[model samples]
Target chain A: MTVTMGKALTAALRDAMREDDTVLMFGEDVGPLGGVFRVTDGLAAEFGEDRCFDTPLAESGIVGLAVGMAMNGFRPVVEMQFDAFAYPAFEQIASHVAKMRNRTRGAVGLPMVIRVPYAGGIGGVEHHSDSSEAYYAHTPGLKVVTPSTVADAYSLLREAIADPDPVVFMEPKKLYWAKDEVSLPVRTEPFGRAVVRVPGSDATLLAYGPAVPVALEAASAAAAEGLSLEVVDLRTLVPFDDATVAASVRKTGRCVVVAEASGFAGVSAEIVARVQERCFHSLAAPVLRVAGWDVPFPPPVLEKYQLPGVDRVLDAVDRLQFDDAPDPRFLAVSP
Target chain B: MTTQAEHRMPAVLPGGVPPADALLPSAEPVRFLDDDGGPAPGDAHGRYERPSTELLRRAYDAMVLGRRFDAQATALTKQGRLAVYPSSRGQEAGEIGAVLALRETDWLFPTYRDTMALIARGIDPVEALTLLRGSWHCGYDPMATRTAPQCTPLATHAPHAVGVAYAARRRGEDTVALVLIGDGGTSEGDFHEALNFAAVFHVPVVFLVQNNGFAISVPVSRQTAAPSLAHKGVGYGVRGERVDGNDPLAMLAVLTDAVESARAGGGPVLVEAHTYRVEPHTNADDDGRYRDHDEVAAWKRRDPIARLEAHLRSAGELTDDDVAAAGAAAEAFAADVRKRLSEEPVGDPAELFAHVFATPTPQLREQAAWLAEELAR
Candidate 1:
């Protein structure tokens, strides 16, 4: 049966809460209101208010209380409501949630997941739409994971909740309605492993979360133009799958990283640096980044110009600076 | 149509507690002892029972030792043995009283200046001083000691205590979490948030705000215009009370009442102990620049240790031999601490890679290997 990403995430929460009585789901408007996005719809009714409850509209308090709850043996799964709204809780996430286990020398490990509806596409106004993954991915102790597909949305969230350390689960707000044919209890490969969605030898597109679909669209567009591009969806960003990423880069010999967050000093920048350092000797050109402009997110109507699209990915693909290789697939297409 | 009673909104706080206004702190700070260590003029504090004679004796011993440890820690900073030490010299009565109010199963979430409380809780002095010694973030196992690491970020630990207490109650455990906050911490957003969450959830937790009159150099006057830090609790529906911090009798009685009420499922309580930070914020700080010496001298006259000793001796609960014994034991503890701290700490570079996560990431493993190779040369 077909399932939307939003439904898959709700199913994941339900299954986790059922599988382990210790798993709790809580956040603002998550209970009776079922969340503004309705991602937690029917959860409180099914799981009861004790298992899934609503909290006051205080972001820091929600996360800070989760930290305490995690330390006391509850596998707390909290929601940040929106991307930029999570800034108030950033101190708690970075200082306490991320450092508890390390600072305590393994005496305390917070088995918690902070679900943030992130990235842009759905014409969300200021503070509602943002790609704040960089803030969490940069924190060492946090496991930053984002899902671009329905199956991944379920599997990754379940695994994240089951993991001992805290995880920042960035649920792409745009992909919440993206539907796919998948059954329940769908277990994907464990975290820290990247998947090669589309195979090609010309160049590779490394993306995660919301950028995965754009990369795939760009790959399809490239294929239609007689150029083959490989798409590698990075499931987890922190324990970055060096083997999978480098192996793909070694095969393709060119790379373009796509992300919705601004490029400068962001996750895209880190990816480009890591790829070039690991695959420098096998490169056809410097790894390019196709990302949002290095500025605050523009108004909803103008966001399209700021967000990376197929054209932008193809533009970077044409700049690979590949040599005059014998195979037409390896040649950089002219604009 | 639904009936009016059915449509009425639920209470902001849980049931079984007194009305919100009744939970407000008294107009004047509550005191059981006068400045001279005798009973107060009226019986305003009579409602709260004084601690038992045995408990009072134990509190006296702990305070004497805690103050000695606090002084020794400060001296260690001057001698280059510690990175820094925030002295709790004059607040021993409240610190010791807070520790004594908790059972072994209860948790104590302390701030950086609560090293004396940690010592009073029977934590090894060296282990409790590890953060100040530049050895580690925290030296002891938090689970074993039921004490969280001394938090440096003010008021941040308040929510954790609430969370722990909430979880404990859910598991049918009678565990209460007592969080220690400074007067300045009451101004932090987390402080208010924690109180609101605790009251809403009806968690078993106690917030003991030691109104030490200073957050570093700024006075409490600059922090908040609230009637009192304890009074700040009423806005969140948590019962707020005040105590004379220097009077060990009052501190013990108030904290005990608050802790027991919460443990009995009466929900969280906030106790504001009016005290003073007699020493500088830290050994490195110059208190003279912030306040006059006369102010410090005036507070010194109300020293918690002297008042407690006088109260205990007059009641005949403590003899001269007991006072001398307490002093001698504290001296020995300080001497042992000095001797042990003279030795430099040995650090293992490998430990840097440990405990960041339950399982170190592949990237961390690679970085650890690189460091190992670099150190091999």
Candidate 2:
């Protein structure tokens, strides 16, 4: 069946609720209003209000409620209305929700999922579009995941809700309506693992969330220009799938990390730093990153210029020097 | 020139509703034992149990031990053994008395000033102060003690307590959480948020606010215009009440009722204890600068320990030997704390990164390794 990201996410929520009675969906306007995006549409009607409900316009309270609910053996998947809007709960998230399990010395563990509609592309007003995966990624106890495809949306969210820890489930707001040919109850790649979207030996383009499609497009466009490119979509931001990244970068000997967040202390910066440390000897050039400019997310019209796009990504890949010709052992498949 | 009826038209709501009742505080703080050595007014059916000889003895002993713990920890800070210590000296009755009302299954979330409460809840005095020692994040296992780490951030733990109480209720467990905050904690947004959520959810929790006159240097008058801090709970639909924090019997009775009623599905209660912070905010602070010495002297005159001793003697419930023995036990406990605190804490660079998670992530592992290498060199 062909389905949009919202439909796929709803299917996942439906399946999770139908499968487990303990699983609940709640947030501001998530109940009768079906959430502002309607991703949680029809959930309250089907499962009843207690299972899917609305909360006060208090982000800290919503997140804190989930933390408490998780402590009592409920798997709560709560939504933070928007990317920038989730800042009100930053303390509750960082100080308590993320640290409770560790503070209790693992005697108690939390199974809570925080769903944040993130990244730019939709012409939203201020405090709506921000690629906030970096904040959660930097946090130690949090498991951060974002799905670029519909299949992964169902599977990763399912797994995230089931995991015995807190997860920041970043749903790329731009991809919410993007349809993909996929079916439910089908096995998808596990969460926290990266998938090589396209295989090439020239340069490895690493991206996650909204930038995955841009990376793939850049690779497709780059291939037309006679330059092969390998694209790795890091589905999970934390638990970073370093081995997969290292293998791809080591094979290609050149890397470029792409993300929508700014270059200063971003998710890409960490990925690039990791690649530099592990694949330093195999590098033909410095690992470059294509990211947002170091400025606050601008108005809708300027966001296009602010965010990293396909053209910008290809520019970085084009800059990677392929001067060594054969790249020595580039063509050799490892046994 | 306007008639009374014409003047009242705009004042009337669309539905002709009466104006909102002023959010006045509960007029009288709950009191059981009297400072003048007798019961105060307002006991119907005489249903409330009299403070038993055994109960008075236990309360007296705990207060003495709690006071000694505060004095020793304060002295240790002066000697640079402890980084700093927030004393609950004047407010020991409210802290220890209320915490003693909780069961082992109930959770007690306290602020830094309530080290006395943590100790009374069966945590080792040294372990309770570990977070304040500037060495560890928190010392004891919360699961084992059923007590959260003494929260340094004001009012932050209020939500956690409510959440835990709600969670336990969801699990069909018979438990309630009692959160202790100072008067200043009520000014924090988290305090309002937590109380609001707790009341809306009808969670099994009790908020114990020790109105100890000052938060650092901010007095109640400067903090809010509310009649009492308890009155803030009225805005959140909570059962706001006040207790004479200096009266151990009153504090115990009020807290016990709040905790038990909550476990019985009575919803949340916000109890404001009218007390005083007899000491400085911490060893580093100068309480003298913020308030008058005359005020501290006056509050000391109403010292909880001395009042309780007088009540016990007047009632023929305790002998001179009993009070002396309690003092000796408290001294012995202080000696134990000093000895335990003098021993050096084993510093392992690895433990710094440990317990950040149940299983450390790759980034944490990498950072830990870098620290290890740096320490080795």
Please state the interface RMSD for every predicted structure, separated by commas. Answer: 4.3, 9.2
| Model 2 residue A12 lDDT score | 91
What fnat does each of the candidate structures reach? 0.73, 0.44
lDDT of each residue in A176-223, candidate 2, tens digit only = 999989877655777558999999999999999899999999999999
Q: Which residue pairs show collisions in model 1?
A: none
Per-residue lDDT tens digits for candidate 2, residues B165-203, read 877876679888999988888888789989888877778
Model 1, first chain, TM-score of 0.96
Error of 2 at A109 (Å): 3.0
In candidate 2, stretches whose alpha carbon ends up further than 4 angstroms from where it belongs are: A322-335, B1-24, B33-54
DockQ score for model 1: 0.55
